[model samples]
Every structure is written in structure tokens, then in C-alpha cells.
Target: MFETLSALFFAHVLADYVFQTAKMVQTKDRFGSMALHTITVYLCAVVALGSIAWQIAVLAGLHLAIDALKVLWVKTRDDDGIKPYLADQVAHFITIAAIAAVAPTLWADGIWTKDLAQGGLLDISAWAPKMMLLTAGAIYTTRAGGFAVGKLMTPFAAGAPTESLPKGGMMIGILERGLIFLMFLAGQPAGIGFLIAAKSVLRFDAASKNEKAEYVIIGTLASFSWAIAIAIFTLAINNGLNDAPLLEIMAAKD
Candidate 1:
């Protein structure tokens, strides 16, 4: 039953992705187009029982929350709005910090590890697939940061002041990186999925070439950074020095 259910869920997810991609190709006003596109996707999910029928219903719930936040933000705020950006950033930071703080304890307590061990798959020495997913999220963030830098450079060359370029790029990079890091720490695939969806929406509406380039650069760099960090952290943890202090510092209250 689980296998059949998982397969059906995967099919629904694939169809939703295709439908959104097609809509993006046809729509000129990227922002408006994506807003509508996501709404349609949500409608489909509701009608098809995509959320309730899925094994990972929690993920679906998280995705819904993320999408709801995105819709509210885009509708109420300007493209370069500061308040919305800050609010999102703060939320991301808090989420990541919380995850980093509690994950080690959770692992030690045998909550997730015990269940896997029962299936004869326990390996405390080895990072799980879910951990790999978190690492991927971090890498995506680093890539986004790099992309943002590139985009800002173009505007600088076109006579936009150096100050303005950096400021604009930094703002976007902060939001991107913060969200990526947070989602990774939270292990919320739904939240990450929403971020991916938001990117598609932005792509449809992105006007300035430099802006797009910057976003891409930042994303690329974020991904790279995440990969490197994960590798280093995995090594550190395996060596028996879990680096609890560093983790605590990172997770410390802002």
C-alpha cells in the first residue's frame, strides 16, 4: 500500500511541475503568471487529494505554508521591498538555528536512528539520505549568492553606482541564502519546494538581465558553499568531535 501510494504521489508532483513549467513558458508577466500558476497548482492538489493521500503529509502542509507566505508577500510588498525581505530572512534564520540546536540531540536520542536500526539500516557513522538533502539545500543557497554578485556587476558596468549595485545584490543574496540555509536546517522539503516554485515565478517576471544574472550567481555559489560545508561537517562529526560548540554558536539567538 505504501509503495502504490508513494508512486501516486510522485506522479502528482511530476504533473504539477510540468504544468507550472508550461505556464511559465506561455506567460509574459512572470510575476502575475506565477501567482496564477501556483494558485492553479494548489487547486489541483486540493481536488486530487494530493495532500491528504500522500505519505509525507507533513511536507505537504509545510509547502502550503510556504506558498501562503509567498503569496502574501508578493501581493502586499514591492519587488524590492525591505520589510517583507527582512521578515522572511528572520524566519529562515530562526528555523535553521533551531534545527542545528536540536538535530544532534534527536540523533543521539535514537528517535530517527532507532527506527532505521530496526530495519537493519542504522549507521551512526554515516550521514543519511535526509542529511544529504539538507546539504543540497545549502549548496543551492551558495549558488544563488554567487549569481547575485554577477548580476550586480552588470548594472555597475552600465553606469549604476558601485554602491547601488552592491546594496541591491546583497539584499537579494541575503534573502536567498537565509532561506536556503533555514530550509536545509529545518529539513522541510515542502518549504524548499515553495522556494523553487517562487524562483520560477520570479523568472517569468524578471526584467533586468543583470538582476537575473545576479540571482543565478548567488544560487550557484550557495549550492557550492553548502556542498563544501557539508563535506567538512560530515568529516568533523565522523572524527568523534561533533563540534558541538560551533554548532551551538551558529544556532545562537540573533
Candidate 2:
């Protein structure tokens, strides 16, 4: 069940974050754009689930239904704020979990079983699950996490710098969260202190206004907290994939 959930969750994140483009998001109400996005979801499932099966169809079809409903709700309410965004994501996650609960054995006779299951570097089947979880972690910590933080920080945006470089803040958040994710993966949480200190020094501005400083502090804390939580969850899932208890894995790492 965990395996299935991890794979489907990864596919969903990949489809929604990485494969999905800004134009696709903007035009999601259109059938062509929605269908293209659903296709991407289907293909991502094919890769993550390691098979072409009916389960994948169910996953994609339900995803399309959820997205269609979200679009309809947004149009009816004439609002595309964070409420609908978070709700839509929650719906998709519930759908993924449902499918995972009943998903069949995807790796038993999957695409990777024939040519690559022998072992070693070519044994994709052996590593694909962990890879999926790790990739999902990376995407969530950067792209998805950025989107979430941006939405949550909307109210506080009034005090943010108006003269900043184009997408500079977004880029900085991505890099910061990515570095945090890697640090957790490497079991070096201590390094995050240095990262925070370095950023503080670099962004030490006129020291006259505190609004921008407060906003920056809030955003950084949110980003770091989200990255850390996701990183721990990813590592826990990876440990489970390896058939090891979380405590045992941590102990071994130590």
C-alpha cells in the first residue's frame, strides 16, 4: 500500500508541478489544455506505477474529474484564490490515496521487470520506488512548496519589496528550500544554521524599515519548516521502501 501510494503521489506531484506549465494552469478551464494536462498525468503515472494498466486509467480519469470540478467551482464563484487551490489539491490527494489502497501489484510484471530487473545499475525496478519518493520530495520542496508559501504569504505581500528583480524572490526560495532538502537528505541539519546566517548577512538592508524584514523572516521560516517536514517524511518513506524501521534506519545513519 505504501509503495502504491508513494508512486501515485510522486506521479501526481510530477504532473502538477514539473510537467505542468504556467500557460496550462492559466488555460486549465479549456478542454484542450485540461486534456493535455491529464495526458501528462497519465504518462507520469505510467512511469511511476511502472506499468500500463487499468489502475493508471482510473487514476487519470479521476484526476480529470477532480480538475473539472475545480474549474467549474472557480468559474461559478468567480474566484481563483488559495481556498480553491488548496481544496483542489486535497481532492486530488484523496483520490490518489483511494487508488493506492486498492492498486494492484504494479511491479510484478512491469516494464522494468524484463530487461532491467536482473540487478545492479540496470535494475530500475529495485530503485524506482525510492527514486520516486526522492524526486517527489525534491519537487515538493522547491516548486510545489514555493507555490504553497506564495499563496499563504499573499496577505503579507503588501510590505514586500516592490523593486526586487524579476522572480528573484521565487528563485531564492527554490534554491533555499532545495539546499535544505539536500542537507536533510545528507543528515546534516546543522548546516541549515549556516545557511540562515549567510542569508541574513546578505539581505541585511538599510535597517531602517522592519516590514520587509518581518516579511522575509516569515517567508524564510515557512520555507524552511515546509522543506524540513517534507524531507523527514521523504526519508521515512524511503526507509520504509528499504523494509527498515524508521528508528533503525536513523540509528544506522547515526
Q: Best candidate per lDDT, number?
A: 2
Alpha-carbon lDDT of model 2: 0.80
- Model 2 lDDT tens row, 100-156: 767646654466544644431234666667677788889988988898789878877
Q: Score every model by TM-score.
A: 0.35, 0.85
Instruction: Write the residue-wise lDDT of candidate 1 on 142-197 in tens digits.
Output: 54334434443443344332443556645655565566566434444246567666
Which candidate gets the maximum TM-score versus the true structure? Answer: 2
Off by over 4 Å in 1: 1-63, 80-86, 96-117, 120-125, 129-134, 146-241, 247-254
Candidate 2: where are CA atoms >4 Å away? 116-123, 206-208, 246-254
TM-score of 1: 0.35
